[model samples]
Target chain A: MFWRKLLNIDSKIIYVVVGLALLLPVIKPVGMPVSISEEYTRRFYNYLTDIPKDAVVFFDLSFRETGEAELGSSVLPAFELLQKRGVKIVCGGQWQQAPFFMQSRLEKKAEEIGSVYGVDWVNIGYKPGGTATWRAMMEDFWKGAAGVDCNETKFDELPLMDRVRKLDKETFAAIVIWQAGTPGSGTWMQYAPDIPLLAVYMGGIGGNARYLRSGQVQAMIGGMQQAAEFEIITDCLGDATGLLDAQSLAVLVVIAFIVLGNISWIMVKRQDSLERSS
Target chain B: MNMDPLIMLEAVGTIAVLSYVWKENAAYRFFEFTAIGLVAAHSIVQTWNNYLKPTVRDRMIGDGEWYLLIPAAIGLLYYTRVMDKKFSWLARYPISISIGYSIGYSLAYSPRPFLKEFRNNFASFGHVNDYIFLLVWLLVVFYFIFTLMKKTKKTLRVTGAITRCLIMIYMGVLFGTSILGKFSRLLGRYQFLLRDWLRLI
Candidate 1:
C-alpha cells in the first residue's frame, strides 16, 4: 500500500512526532540505573593521577566556549587531575576566542592549584598560523609562535617559554585537546605528534560526540557523560550531575521510539502476512 | 534592565535554535546567520588585534622591514581573481603553497604513531579484552572492502553480525551524547531567559 497516500496524514504531524520525542523525556525519565564502565574510570583517574609534578602538559582549546556541553564535562576531569598532580601547563587555543574562553576557567582552576599564570602555566593565545604553524610548533616549538603570551605579553618575558624555546625532543606528558568537531581530535593528532592526544569537546547537539568514543581515540570524556563521571569521581556534583537523570531519561525515550518503530513495522508485516494467508 | 542583555539573548537564541525540529524556516535561518556572522566578525577582529596589528603591522612599520611585504604581496594575489584572466593564475601559487604545506606538515606527524597503533592492533591476537574488539575491527574492515568475495551465507552472516553489533553500540552512544548536548544548549537559553530577561531565576 502507498501508506502516506492511503492514510492522508497531514504534514503538521511530522512536527508533533519530533516535539513529543524530545519533550516526553523531559517530563518523565525511564529511571534506569547507569553502571560506570570500569576501564574508562580507571584509565581516566589513573592516567591523570599518574603524571608527576612539573611534567609539561599541552592543553589545546580547539573549540570555543559555547561548546561547553560536549567539552565542559571532559575537560573538567582532566583539569582536576592536572591541578591535583601539579602538572605544568603550556596552553594554546586553536580558536580565536580561546584566550578569553580559557582565561575564565583557568582563573578559578589556577586558584585551586595554587598555580601562577606566567610561572606555572602560560597561554600562547590563538594560533591563526593554522597547520603550518602547528607543524612549526612540533619542530621549533615557537617558530609560528615566538613571542606574545595569551595575555599579550612578550614570550621572552614569560617563564613557560624558557622550556618551550628549547623544542629539541621536548615532549609533553600529554596533550589535552578540546575539540567541538572539524579540525578537532583528528586534526591535533596529525598536526602535533609530540605527545599523547586527549580528545575533549563541547559535544555537538546530536551524534557527533560518539565519533570520538570509538577506539580511534585513546580515551574520551564522553561529553556530558564524561562531565558527570568527573563529578562522580571527584565526589563533587555540579550542574552536570544535577541534570544527569534528565539526560539519561532523554536517551531512554529515544530507545523507546526505536522499539516502537520496530513494533509498528512488525505489526504491519504480520497484518500483510494474514491477508496473504486468507 | 533587570538582568544582563547577554543572558536574555542566550535564552532567546537557544529556543530559536531548537525550533528547527518543527521545520527549518525563517526563525532558524535568522539564528543560524547570526551565529555565522558573529563568529566571522569575532575571528576577523581577533586576528587583527592579536596577530596582524600587534606583530605584523608593528614589525613592518617599526624597522621598515620590507621583507614582511612578501607574504602581503602573495596574499594580494588572491584578489587577482576579480581583475583579469591572466592575473587569475597568480592565485594558484598561494593555493599550491597551502596544499604543499598541509601535506608536508601532515607527513611529519602521521606516519609513526599510526604505524605503532597498527602494530599494537596486530600484536594483540588472543588477549581477552582486545580479542573480540580486534576481530570486530577486522570483520568491519573486510565487510567494507568492496572487492572482497563472499562465497556463502555464512560469510554474509558474519559480516552482518559484526556490522550490527558495531551499529548498535554506535547508536546507543550517539543517542545519549547528542540528547545531553542539545539539552545543555537549551539550558543555556533557559538560564538567559529566566535569569537575564525575566529576573525570575
Candidate 2:
C-alpha cells in the first residue's frame, strides 16, 4: 500500500520539493565547488587567453531571451577577457532578440573593463538573413551588416569596423558563439569552416561532443555548469557561480524522485506478480 | 523589497507564469498571452527598423537603387498566400526561389564539413576512447541495415541488442542535458525573484 501510494504521489508535491530545492540555495548559498572540465571549459579558456592583442573576434549572440540564463552567463566573462586582452569584437546574432538582451550587457562590461566603444567593440546587431547573411559577411562585412551598427551607426565611423572588412581568418582571429538552437554554430562550421569556432551551448553537449572530437569546433562550453566554471577560471564570478548550489540541490531532488519512482514501481510489480500467481 | 516598477512588473509576471505549475488560472493566461504578443510585436518592429528601413533609406532611396524593388516585389508576393485564394499560387514564385537558393547554397558548402565528420570517425585510433567511439559508431550504423537485419535476424540479434543499448544510453545523456538546461533557466528566474525583485539574497 505504501509503495502504491508512493507510486501515485501527487506531481504537485514533487514540484514544490524541486521549487524549494532551487529556492533555498538562493536564500543561503552553499557555494558548492564546481570543477572545470579540461576538455571543454579549459580549452575554451585557453583559446580566449591565447588570442593575440588587438586582433578582431566575431561574437554571435544567437540565443533568445529564454536561453539567456544559460548561454548568456558566458557572454559577459568572454567580453571581459577579450576586452582586457585588447582584442576587438564585432557582435551580431542569428536570433532577433539577441541584440536587445546582449548589446547592453556587452556595453556595460566594456565600460567596466575600460574598453572604448567602436574601437574596442562594435555590435552590428541582429541581421535577419541566416546563412546567406553570414556568407555575405565573409566576403564583405560592412555590406553584409547593411553598413551599420546596432544603433544604426554607420560601420565607416567605427574604427574597429575599419579593421574588420570581412569575417575571414585574416580579419577575425576566431568566432565565439553563444548558441541555443538551430542556425547557430553549425551554420558557422558549414559556411566559415576556415575560422576557428568556439561555442557555448545552452545544452546538448552530448550531441556536439563529436564536433569537438572531430576538430570542427575548436572548443566548447556547455550549459550553466561550464558557465560557472568559466567564471571561476576568468575570475569574473557572476550569477552562474552564485546559483550552482541551487542547481546541485535541484538535480539531487530530481535524482531522488527518479530513484523513489523506480523502487516503488518494482515493489508494486513484485506484489502484483505474487497475487496473480496465488 | 526592490519596489522598482520594472522589477515589480517582472516579479508579477514571473509569479503569474509560475503559478500555472500549481493550477491554470487567469493570471497565467493573461501573462502568457502578454508574453506572446510582446515577442511578436518586438519581432515585427525589429525587422522593420533593422532590415527594411535601412534598405529603403540607404539602398533604395539614398543610393537610387530602384532595382531593389524587383526583389522586394517578389518577396511581397508571399503575402498573397493569405490575402486571396485566387492568386495564392503566386506565393510559389518566392517559395521556389528561396528553396532553390538554399539548396544550391547548401550543396556548395555543406559537403566538406559532413565529409570531414565522416573521415574523423576513422581518422583516430590513438586512444581507448577513440576506439570505443569508432566501435559504437559502427554498431549504430550497422543497426540501421534494415534489409540485412531482416534476412539474418538470429545472427544479428546480439549486435542489435548492443546497438539498442548504446542508443538508449546516448538518448539518456541527451535527455539529462535537456533537463539541466531547463533547471538552469528555472534557476535564473529564481535568482531574479530573490536578488533583483525581493532583494532577499
Alpha-carbon TM-score of each model against the true structure:
0.80, 0.95
**In angstroms, how far off is B66's CA in candidate 1?**
4.0
C-alpha lDDT values of all predictions: 0.63, 0.87
Q: Which consecutive 10 residues in model 2 chain A have the weakest lDDT in total?
A: A64-73
lDDT of 1 at A57: 82
Tell me the tens digit of each residue's lDDT in model 2 across A97-135.
887678888878888889998989988888877777778
For model 1 the TM-score comes to: 0.80
Q: How well does chain A score by TM in each candidate?
A: 0.75, 0.96
Highest TM-score: which candidate? 2
* Model 1 C-alpha lDDT per residue in residues A1-278, reported as the tens digit of each score: 44323244454664355445444433443444545546554455666677788788877877665565445545555666676667878878676665566677777877876778777888888877676667666676655674677677887787877878632325687776776656666655554444666665454323432223333445556555666666678665554554455555555665665676566667677778889999
* Pairs that clash in candidate 1: A67-A202, A70-A201, A70-A202, A70-A203, A71-A201, A71-A202, A73-A227, B11-B189
List runs of model 1 lying over 4 Å from the truth.
Answer: A1-36, A74-77, A97-99, A111-114, A166-171, A201-219, A272-278, B23-27, B58-65, B146-148, B151-184, B187-201
